[model samples]
Target chain A: MVTKFRTTIAALAASTILATSAFAGELVINTDTSDPAPKAAFEQLIADFEAANPDITVKWNLFDHEGYKTSIRNFLTADAPDLANWYAGNRMLPYVNAGLFEDVSDVWEENGLNESLASAAGSMTIDGKKWGVPYTYYQWGVYYRKDIFEANGIEVPTNWDEFKAAGATLTEAGVTPITIGTKYLWTAGGVFDYLNLRTNGYDFHMALTKGEVEWTDPRVVDTMNNWKELIDAGFFLENHSSYSWQEALAPMVADDAAMYIMGNFAVAPLREAGLTDDQLGFFQFPVINPDVPLAEEAPTDTLHIPANASNKEDARKFLAFLATADVQTKINETLGQLPIHKDATVGDDKFLQAGYAMLSSTDGGIAQFFDRDAPAEMAKVGMEGFQEFMVKPDRLDAILARLEKTRQRVYK
Target chain B: MSASRASRFNQRSLAPVLFLAPAVLFFLFYVIFPIFQSIQISLYDWDGLGPKTYVGVDNYVELMDDEAFYTSLKNNVIWLVLYMLAIPAGLFIALFLNQTVFGMRLYKSLFFFPFVISQVVVGLVFTWFYDPSYGLLNVILGWFGMGPIAILGDETWVTYGIIFAGLWPQTAYCMILYITGLNAVDPEQIEAGRLDNAKGWKMLWYIILPQLKPATFIALVVTVIGALRSFDLVSIMTAGGPWGSSRVLAYYMYEKAFSEYGFRMGYGAAIAVVLFLIMMIYITFFLVKMYRDEKGL
Candidate 1:
């Protein structure tokens, strides 16, 4: 009886293996795009990729945005898919350093992405080698009410003095100069990035994020003082911490607030809230120090093949296809983001055109936003300190001291 | 014949053990093994995927100075103390509704509705209720010219705001438990108390209370566990935010492990071990009480 049972179990296992291997030629892709537009764009890309590659089948897995963050590490180590969607910069560094992500420099060379995807190459590269391919990125800048600026006879500011003058003019007209919401904490990080980028320049900000420079460095102090000047001018919306980024836009839509420093994703929401393109405008964050080169915050999204993937060859083919200007244009146009490939056709929307122009004109290199540039541990404490500083600028010394301690512990 | 009798004896002894094997194996693998694994993992420096380096007691040492840890610990205490209010409040509601009024069954179910919904939903509903500008709570306060208070944003009031949300469902749960317990109360015993003129508080204190001891014990156990495991509300409503002021141990452990802060597996396990030890103290006390009761019986 025992021999018969063992033989039967072996037969069942053999049949299961045979059944699974029947479809072994398929390539699996995992993505986290929970929003409707991005999800639709991803589905369209998948359909297109499948239509283009008739020999290989694609197995796609979709996950909600937050759930994917925790599940990615486990799946990468245990049951890695052919390709996974991830963010660029410090967010991808841990996986790259751990050897979980396959280096895709060959894909870059084969596709000649060096020239086509030049703007995004810096963010995707670590240790002088590119680990992933960037598909889309959006620009962050000062989005303002054009009608309000025109009505007040305020020209778009190009430097710190002019910026403050604009704020003063808006305040005199009984409008909030700048609207922000720090309840989720990352919005404050955006402001801090622009401030650091404009004050100390891009190199100093990179070094600061990588833990090479202390938070209490006088240069950082100078950045904080510049931010404090705006706070003391009573230029920002009062009780801004009570609102999320979406809620903070209410004042801007109501004409009570004049400008918001945010990402291009805010455009769709602005239009939904009854603001016309003629009523809105975009500008680069004004330069704080003429000596410091102008850098911009542009967080890019990337795709990578896991090291343990079974279909690495097919994954490479998919990535190369994704990097082409045609594929990128379709994806970005659907998702309403800037395509990484320089030759990709941009949307006819004015905002997209403005963002492309601003990015092309950036003198210094791009740095991912504060959270994406710093290690997550450091980013958490750093964003918290930024929020606290905004609320109580008098606690500058104490907050910086605490942040320095955290940086030492985290980076060590 | 003697050999056959010995085989039968052996089979009788082994039958019960064979029948119980699957459950015991499951408990060992799922519960016991993870506890020991977590204890082992706590002594290392690991980021979930990388090779672990033994860090001795460094994680614990770091946790000692961690202001966030202390804040979570203090909030846990506040949660425990305020969470006990659910029991009394539930009992009061249960007593008030224990009657033969018109549509009492409908009233009972309606009163218990909050407990039936998932905690995540309750959290979202309360988040809107406490919104600083347009929430119902503030709108009502506006009538008195009092509050446009940002409950979730203010550090001092954030923990209280979350606890109050947690209590809404927890109190309803306790009320349901007591209502079931009240159903089993002996009518003869109540009549005997009435003959002795045991009315109102006297009757409840002396007669009804002792009979409800079993229900009270269950309520205490669940309420304590619920308070310690208060993660969903904190995650959904405040995210332990306005500067980590509203964090409890469970949410803090999750934040350290899986949040954007990167996975510090060893540090996160250390936190879990500490929470487990704290919970074990209460479990031991309850077990001792249960053991004593069994012995007396």
Candidate 2:
């Protein structure tokens, strides 16, 4: 009886030692930034954060972007890290609603992030509380070949008529006007979002995405009709559905296509493809309706603390550090994206400057891209319908009707 | 006295039960338990991470009206039917390579190389080969003045493109199996058939193929299972794109469960239950055949 009692006491002591050592002063972070530049930037951020806090050690787990999406659900419930990388706005809604993400309003308040990070506050807020800290977001617009425009004697399009006229001139010159790949389907969403935002204004576009307005509404039909005009002109690269977004850039690089409507991320690839700044120019997606406000597409990436985190104090510290203007500027410089902190100064990169100006224009506030704005279920069907419409414009009615059915079912 | 002791121990021994405990426990926990659990989960409306509300067959009811479900079912049928062609094709290659010639062993290994690579690699290679602008297939067709065909982009052809990619490795696998079976063939029977003036197709059909029943059975069973579980190739090559025209049941179930398209876990479980039932039919058939064969042996 004495030996049994001794063994039990020994076992209890061993477990206590193990438990304390496992979690003491160790902050775990799970991130999904598979792209080389962003991954390097995050690694640097971690190094800086670690240097700033000598007492605390960080354990970083990096996941490939696609696999991370599926695994996040598993890890967030089973063995959540102290902090995780996620997105702002509707993408983070489900997690916030499920209480998987912790409320980090204290972090914001303690760091005085309200003024510096004010631009992204609206997106990160849920139920009158902040759920995450948005670090980076970039603008989407028309990137055109300036040399081609000059050679064709065409002016930069400011509105729908000029845009169509430019397309006609490019088509006559044997150049596809726009190069877009819809094989992965999200590229179609980019085009559809711009059209919907420009045609029906941001409120109606948000309403449609939120399923408050029917997809079959006449306003949506008007958007499709405008899109149909571009499709009918044969402006897009031929056999575009066969390529990914990167592959579609080949035509633009080769002067076979003159323009691409894409995010600011494409600037690096365009430069790598041997285009000079003089050759490439940026413009906002042309105004379809002059009276409508021009809301831009800006999908923000965020950092969040999981509700079940074991090291909440350290996680909050890291989030506060990440929200600083210096840290935000450094990271966004590496990422080639706009910083969320208002005081964070971007480098003299022309595209970054243009993106900052365009996104911050007084015409309208930012609208997250279609897939990010809508629930994922609705986005999948909506994007598929957009792709189908691009291929067969005559099927617009059928496609919109089908999307209406999915929206009703999903949002219900 | 020792003999009596040994007999008593044998009569009351728990050795056999203890020996089987680990494997039986694992089988129950990992395989048997999950199947029933999935069935239970399929009766609810759960989004994987949230509270489950029991909705009782509503997912299946919703699936009835889902056009994507019908598309997946049709594609699965196509996959199953076309996958069987691998067996005959493999046999043909095995016969062609089963000869006494210089470098014959190397030839056999070369023919078996595709099966050695992972299906994901094969899918990627075929995706590149079918690329419309800069693919080998299009390059070859260009010599004949034929234009490009976007096989993966066209809904009508995307399923066939993926299936063809899947069949490449599957056929190689069957070929290796048949070659092994041919190595164990009774040469005396072949000589006897030669003496009877049976050669070529006649000798192969009547004399040789009869000895390959076991190999044929294994090949058929694996091919059928592979066809039904053809998620990797479709996922890698096309991701059921061109408006989901190429989705098989397995891929569709995964999409419903884990994709960014909302985590409808209960709906996905229902789809999995349907796939399981379909696979169970073949499993029962295979087991019954094996049992009969065992009795015959």
- Where model 1 places Cα greater than 4 Å from the true spot, the runs are A1-25, A169-174, B1-12, B192-197
Expressed as tens digits, the lDDT of each residue in B1-297 for candidate 2 is 999999778767867777889999999987998798789888998876667799998999998889889999999999999999999999999989999999999999998999999998999899899999899999999999996988998888999999999889899989989999999999999999999999889998999999998899899988999999999998888778877788999999999988878588889999999999999999899889889988995
The residue pairs in collision within model 2 are: none
Report, for all candidates in order, the number of backbone clashes: 0, 0
Minimal lDDT window, size 10, model 1 chain A: A13-22
Best by DockQ: 2
Please estimate how well model 2 matches the true structure, expressed as its whole-model Cα lDDT. Answer: 0.88
Task: Provide DockQ values for all models, in the order shown.
Answer: 0.46, 0.53
Output the number of the TM-score-best candidate. 2
Off by over 4 Å in 2: A1-22, B2-13
Tens digits of per-residue lDDT, candidate 1, A1-412, equal 2233235444654453222222456988888998888899899998999999998888888878877887687667656789999999999999999999999999999989988999888888999899999999989999999999999999999999999999999999999999998888899999999999999999999999999999999999999999999999988887666678999999999999999999999999999999999999999999899999899998899999999888989999999999999999999999898999988999888888999898988889898889999998999989988887887889899889989999899888
What's the TM-score of chain B for every model shown? Answer: 0.96, 0.95
Score candidate 2 by DockQ: 0.53
> Interface RMSDs of all predictions?
5.5, 6.5
Q: Candidate 1 chain B: minimum summed lDDT over ten consecutive residues — where?
A: B257-266
